[model samples]
Target: MKKHCMGRVVAASAVLVSSGAIAFVPASAASATEADCDGIGVIGVFKAVESGASFNYNGRRVELQNESALDRYSRAEIKSGRKAGDRLWVDRSFHAFPDFKGIVSDQSAKSDGWKMCGPYTGSRTQSVFNANYAARACAEIDGTTLCGKWYVD
Candidate 1:
């Protein structure tokens, strides 16, 4: 008597049957979708002008002008029985000026969407200077997260 294990491979997506039971393996599992953010409904939208950077949140707005540096903007959605949203923004500056400011917002409902913004500045001197800026957007729904980022130099 000879015993053999018979199997076949399909085009990535395949079904295996054994003992009157079947299981399926999908072709692609890692894909970017809206549910990447873990149900967090927060987004960050930022812009940079000649002087500084500006950010907005759910119709609420904050602007940093002249001699300021925007650091990071982040958002997260909380999964609860009712659902909620959270947002955070941070900035920094120097030279006898206190340029660090932090902003945060919370929403009562999970289905609600939120936004945030901030600025980014590089080093400078009397002779040579470097100016840079950036922006980002993020959102989450159904336990999925999505994000987009941009920069200027």
Candidate 2:
């Protein structure tokens, strides 16, 4: 159910930025549709402006901006379709969604999708999927060339 959410997209996209620090977000019991991203646990995130809104599938929004983390990690967001329409996530492949590079978490991982995003993290207390893919982030932060270790699933 998409409203005239372009401005909302831009507004949301505008806030897409990650702080160069770690904040362990606990995983949720089930998948969620809220912007809070209850189920999907985001390991790490950075200024992946190069990804170019990987969350947007065929122009529809998939992930919601992480408001608390300055939109760093585009939290996996599920929107209720008309009577729950079919999701295009079936054909799991890198080029499945040419314009998008979705995180493809948990179930989505079973099927091919875009590379993951975050830091190489771990959790002994519970199950956490950590991808070793390195995502180098080199962005100008406060007039300084900020570059360091960022991860991609």
Candidate 3:
């Protein structure tokens, strides 16, 4: 099953490569962030710490970039994968992420674009930023980062 799944990914990659949709790079090779976010590149998938939500930082760790850039890439990720159903859909259970902005380190200010629902006020449309780091009473007030608790299924 794993091999079959990987085969699909490889075939998809080949099609993308041939059509100039994305460049072809060996899995062992290093590519730029644009390539990674461009469908032709590999995205690093991360599971939500709490709800088992699955997401990708567009190949960069969420812990690394600024909010603006993160938003840009995340938007791309969401739009790029509709056919594959690779979106960060919030479950009806939790409903939404908390409002009221909190300050995040300037280091974490950028995001890969699509945060779960909570951090951006229940609108998956909002971008995640360092200013909205996990501390500010989002869901329960004084809780941990929303990303740590929310699922992206």
Top TM-score prediction, candidate number: 2
Return the lDDT, model 2, position 45: 42
- How would you order the candidates by TM-score, starting with the best? 2, 1, 3
lDDT of 1 by residue, 70-106 (tens): 3332221111221233322221111111232222111
Candidate 2 lDDT by residue in tens digits, 1-153: 212212111111112226422111122122212232122444544222224322322233322222234333332222322123322110111223223333433222223322322211111011122222122221211222222222233
Return the top candidate by lDDT.
Answer: 2
Model 3 residue runs over 4 Å out of place are 1-65, 69-76, 79-81, 89-124, 132-153
Please list the residue runs of candidate 2 whose C-alpha ends up more than 4 Å from where it truly belongs after superposition: 1-50, 67-74, 78-83, 87-153
Candidate 1 wrong stretches, greater than 4 Å: 1-131
Between which residue pairs do clashes occur in model 2? 17-71, 17-72, 44-118, 116-153
> Cα lDDT of model 1 overall?
0.23
lDDT of candidates 1 onward, in order: 0.23, 0.24, 0.22
lDDT of 3 by residue, 1-46 (tens): 1111122111112212232222222332111222212222223342
The per-prediction tally of clashing pairs is 11, 4, 19
TM-scores of all predicted structures:
0.19, 0.20, 0.18
Q: Is candidate 1 or 2 superior in lDDT?
A: 2
